[model samples]
Every structure is written in structure tokens, then in C-alpha cells.
Target: MKYYSTNAKAPLATLHEAVVKGLASDSGLYMPEYLYKLSADFFDSIQNLPFNEIAKIVATAFFGEDVEQKALDEIVDDTLQFDCPVVEVSDNIYSLELFHGPTLAFKDVGGRFMARLLQYFIRKEGKEEVNVLVATSGDTGSAVANGFLGVDGIHVYVLYPKGKVSKIQESQFTTLGKNITAIEVNGVFDDCQALVKKAFMDEELNRHMKLTSANSINVARFLPQSFYYFNAYARMKAAGKADNLVVCVPSGNFGNITAGLFGREMGLPIKRFIAANNANDVFFKYLQTGKYTPMASIQTIANAMDVGNPSNFARVYDMFDGDLQKIRSVVSGATYSDEQIRETMKSCFDSNGYILDPHGACGYRALEEGLTDGETGVFLETAHPAKFKETVESAIGAEVEIPERLAAFMRGEKKSVEMSADFDSFKNFLMTR
Candidate 1:
């Protein structure tokens, strides 16, 4: 499949080139040239199909032309070892529990898929060491780090804001030493993201060493995320609640929602979407006034959604052809403060006895206010609440049991490199490495 840059200036890239280059030469996010719509038969029998089957069908649409059927199926099977079950939280409302994977977050699917796909290409082309640069606020670092951990011929560098991520989130990435290196940037999530983008754009750095991003800006990383959307729809259809299905995503870099939008274009039977945001409400403001405005990020309990200038806004804008009204018609926006997030978490636990991570709280609360009668709402419970144990326990006045997976990470000692947010400093560090 041919992939084009959203910027429209860079040359079109093949699947291998797009996955390797990550960002286009024009500094635009790569998007597939065509979207393959699923057959009516697929949707008709979707309720009977398992998650792996649903994901394989969707993955085939995105990658079948470039990759062999056996390889693609293996990648899908390996990536989705766990299911994203849709559990009912209240009447007409459900939570798509996506934290059942190895990293205990929704990103595990994308992160693992990207890692395996990249390794496939590396082996195919006989390439030398490929460095993966990923910037994360919370869960993404751990997901990508653990996904690429100890994988031969690839090294992952996780750049995260210092003192901004949860302790558990930090431990997940920083504790892993093999092939995964954590860099603590002395700034916000946006700064770390900027460093990754700049490194991709730097001529000398790219020439010196092969650098690719594991962030959602990469086509491979974001496109596979569409798999879960199809899987979620299949589960909802099985439960006889597929009519007027509204999926709420807690927005950060906007990649997750963009992937869902791609699914919608490919005929995923989604009624609409809601992008829930924290205090950093740039996308919310854009939905309100039809003006795209970005600002500095604010530190909140939902740290993952704290991206102020989301990198994937380019893809979202390009996907809608920069039509604000059309984008608004399909997708709505909602924003909440830290206090509001806490209130939602506390209230949901008190009322439904369902614990929500701060990020998922934004999604659940958005559905609570946005869903109309007869519309089935499925909000993404993006991560395990135990990852944010302190905040969740304080909000609900109860202790959260740390999962054994998370406890293992906490048990490991942290090892990381500290760096400033300056692009030059980042560039120099990479050039030396």
C-alpha cells in the first residue's frame, strides 16, 4: 500500500519505508493512500467472531497488500493475546476494558504490533540496529518499552517528562534495562515529544543512525490501534447493543481517536465519537470555536491526556480535509479539570462500584453527559486504576490492590538518563550514541 504524508509535500512511501521513516521528510504524519472498507458479510457475522478473528480481518485491510497473510496473522495473534472486553457499567453505558495486555494499558496492542512489524521489516531488509524514539506522559512509555524490550536489532528510548508520570508508570519503563533506555526530559510531555520529532527531522542525526518513532505519529503504531475498535464493535454487537454505538476516547496525542476515525471510514458501524480531555483542552476548544489553538500542558492526575499541542492533530485535521463542520458532525469534544476527574472517579465508584483511572474518568464522564436515549455508550478504560493507585485510592477513599504485574515493575530498580528538553542537546546525545 502506498502511504502519503499529510503535509502533501513529501514523496509517497511504501509500507516498509513509511514504517521505517516514521515521520515523512516533510515532517508530516504518514496516512495510507486508501482505506479499504469491510464487507457486509463481515459485519453480519461479526458477533460470532472472536477478537483475534475480528482484528485479523481489520489488519488484513490495512496491511495485507504489503505483508504475507501468514506473517500478518501471526503478528495480530501475538499482539492481541488478551481481549478488550466490553463490560456494562450502567444502563446503556459500558467500559471497554483495554488494560488486560502485558503492559496493562490500551497501548500494548499498538506498541506490540509496531514492535513486531518493525522487526519483520528489519529482518527482511537486513538492516542494522534501529533506534525507536518514543515520548510518553504515562502509559505509552511503559507500553512501548515493554513491547520492544529485549527484541533483537532494535533499541527503544523512552523520553518522558521528569516528575510528571506516575511512579508505577515510571517503574514500568525505567526498570527495564535490556534494549530499552529511559530518558527523563526536564520539561512537559510536549517537550519530550518535540525532542523526538526534532530528532527525526535532523539531517545529521538520521544520517548517522537509523531513527524511528514508536509514537502514534508512525503509521504502524496508530493503524493497528484500529483493531480494538473493530473488536469492541464485535463484542457490543454480540450483546445486542450495537445500535447507535458511541465510543468515547480520553484524548491526549489524539492518535487513538484518529485510529477510530479511520475505522469509521472503513465502515466500522460506529455512530459517533467523543474525545474526552483533561485541563489541557486544546482539542476541546477547537471543537467549540472551530479554531485550532495549542498551549502549554498542565500537570493533572490524568497525565497521559495532558498533551497541549498534540502531534496527531495534523493527521486528524488532514483526515477531515480541514473541514471543521464535518469533523464536528462525526466527533464531539469534552473537557474536565482534575477536581472534576476526581469527582467522576469517586461518584462512579460510589454509585456503580466501578473504579476508574483518572484518564478513564474523563471518558466515562463524557459519556455520562453526552449520550442520548437509545444510544449505547462504550468508553475506553484506557489503563488499570492501580497504575494511578495514590490518586484513585484518595478519590474513592479505599486502597487499590496493585496488580502482580505492576508490583513486579515496582520491585525493579530504576535506571535512566537525565536530559534537558533542548533539541540541540537531544540531537548531540543521539549523534554520539
Candidate 2:
């Protein structure tokens, strides 16, 4: 299927071009030309299939025209090595646990899927080395860095705000010394994201080396996220709790929630969506006032959602044809302060014996407040709480055990190149490399 630029200024691009280019020439995120809705029979029997099987059906719908059946199946199998299970957090409220992957964060699905898809295209076309530029507030760096680690003919550059990410998150990316390079930017996550966007738009940098982004701006990265939404729906359906199904996402760059929106378009039967935010509530404010105003991000315990200007907002706006009423009808927004996030985390653990990462806390609180009668809400538990050990411990007032996989990352020695968030500095660094 062809993909069009959200800006509508660029020519139509094939799946290959969309996947490799990452961003449209017009500096807008890519959107699929058409959405392939699932058949009614598929949804009826969806619960019987395994996670990867459900994903393959969805992946084929989105990619079958471009990718061969066998190859696409292989990619789906390789990418989803872990399951995102739906666990009960409370009555009529479930948590889609998405932290069971290698990096133990939600982006693992997109990160790993993008890595394999890019590698497939590179190998198929015999293309030269492709450089992946990803800016992470926290988990994205680790997820993308580790996803492309040691892959042949590809190098991943992870730019992250210095001293802003959790120590565990930092260790996950900075320690990987293979094809992954972590850049510690002396600025906020927004500045790091700006540097990436500028690098993509710079002609000199493009000429110096092929550049693409793994951020949600890339169709390859975010589109695969819809897989789990289908899987989550199937799980809910199996549990007979699919009625008035509401999915809440702890949104940051808005890629995660945008993917969910796409699933709804493909007829996933999601009743509606709630975008949960921390203090950096640009999207939240936009929902309230129907005005989008980007500002500098504010740091909170849920650092992953610390996006001041979510890049995927362009895709969301374009998807809804710039209609605020249409967007509002399908999606709602909620914001929480750090104090609220902490309180929700503590209260949930106290009552349900379920620990939530700070990001997930925002989603849980939103569902708790926003769910109407007869609605079953599923908030995405986007990351493992152990990723934020200190913060979780303080909130729950108990020791949090670090998973062995995360503990292994902590043991690896840190290695990173410190750079300013200035575009010139980033350009020179890339050119020099």
C-alpha cells in the first residue's frame, strides 16, 4: 500500500520508501493511503489465535501488498518474541502489560519490528548502511538501541536528554557498544527530538549519510504498534469484557495512542481512547480548548510522557482531517501532576497489589476517573516499574525488585558521547562519523 505525507506536499511513497525514509520530504509524518479493515469472521475467532497469529493477520492487512506472505510472517514471528498480556488491575479495569520484551518497555514492539523491517529492506535492495536516529525521553532509547543492536549494515544513534532518563534506562542503551551509539544531549527531550528532525531535514547530512528516524513519526515504527491493540481486543473479547471497551494510553510523543487510533479505523471495536499525560500536557490542553500549542516539556516522574510537542500530533490531526470535534468524539485527554501520579501508584499498589510504572499511573488514574457506566477500561501498562526503581520504591514505599534482564543491563559499563542539543553540533557529529 502507498503512504502519503501528512503534510500532503510529498509524492506518494511505497512501503519500501516509507520504511527507509522514515520521514516525508515535506517534514511531515507518513500516513497510510488506505486502512485495511479486518473481516467480521476474523474478529469473531480472533481470541482463538495466538498473539503472533493475530499480529500476522493485522500485519498482512497493513503490509501484505508489499511483503510476501512468508517473509511477513517471519518478520512478525521475529518481532513478537514476547507477549503483551492483559492482566486484571481492578474490577472492569485491565492493564495491558507491554513490558515483557527484551527492553521491558512498550516501544519494544515497534522498535524490534522496525529494526527487522529495515534490515529486510536493506538486505532485499542490497542498500548501503542506514543510520537510525531516535530521540527518547526514557524507554525509547533503550528499546530502539537494543532493537537494532548488532544488526548488520545498520547503525542506531540514540539521542537522550542528559540526567533526565532513569539510570536503568540510561544503562540499557549506553552499555550496548555494537552498532548502537548513544548520544547524551545536554538538553531536554524536546531539544533532542528537534536535533533529530533538523538532521533529517538537512540536505548536507542526508548527502553525508542516509538518515531515518525510529520515532513514532516513522510509519514502520508506529504502524506495527496496532498489532497489540488487536491482540488486546482479542484478549478482552475472550474474557467477555469487550463491551464498551475503552483503551487508555499513557501518551508522550503520541505515537502509541495514534497507533491505537489506526486500529480503531481498521475496526478494532475500541469504544474510545483516553490519552493520559503528565505535567507536559500540550495535547491535554489541546483537547480541552481545541487548540494545539507546543511548549517546552516539563519533567515529571513519568518522564516518558515528557513531550512538550508530540510529533505524532500532526498525523493525528491529519487522520481526523483537522476536525477537532471528530478527534474529540473518538479520543479524550487527561493530565496529572507528579503528585497525582505518585498517589495513584501508591493507592493502586495498596488496594490491588499491582505495581504501576509512573507512565502507567497516569493511564490508570485517567480510566478510574473517565470510565462511564458499563465500560470496561484497559490502560496500557507501558513499562515495567523496575525501570524506575527509585521512583517506584518511593511511591509504593516498598522495595521493587529489578528484573534479571534489567539487572544485566545495569552491569554493563556505560559508554556514550556527550553532545549539545544544538543542531550544528549534532550535524557536525554526524558528518564526522
Give the C-alpha miss distance for residue 128 in model 2, angstroms.
0.7
lDDT of 2 by residue, 269-328 (tens): 999999999999999899899889999999899999999999999989998999999999
Q: What is the C-alpha lDDT of each candidate?
A: 0.94, 0.94
Q: Write the per-residue lDDT of candidate 1 for residues 2-99, one digit (tens) a residue.
A: 99999999999999999999999999999999999899999999999999989999999999999989999999999988988999998899999999
Q: Estimate each model's TM-score.
A: 0.99, 0.99
C-alpha positional error of residue 261 in candidate 2 after TM-score superposition, expressed in Å: 0.6
Error of 2 at 17 (Å): 0.8
In terms of lDDT, which candidate is strongest? 1
Candidates in order: C-alpha RMSD to true structure:
0.7, 0.7
Under the 3 Å rule for N, CA and C atoms, how many clashes does model 2 have?
A: 0
* TM-score of candidate 1 to 2 decimals: 0.99
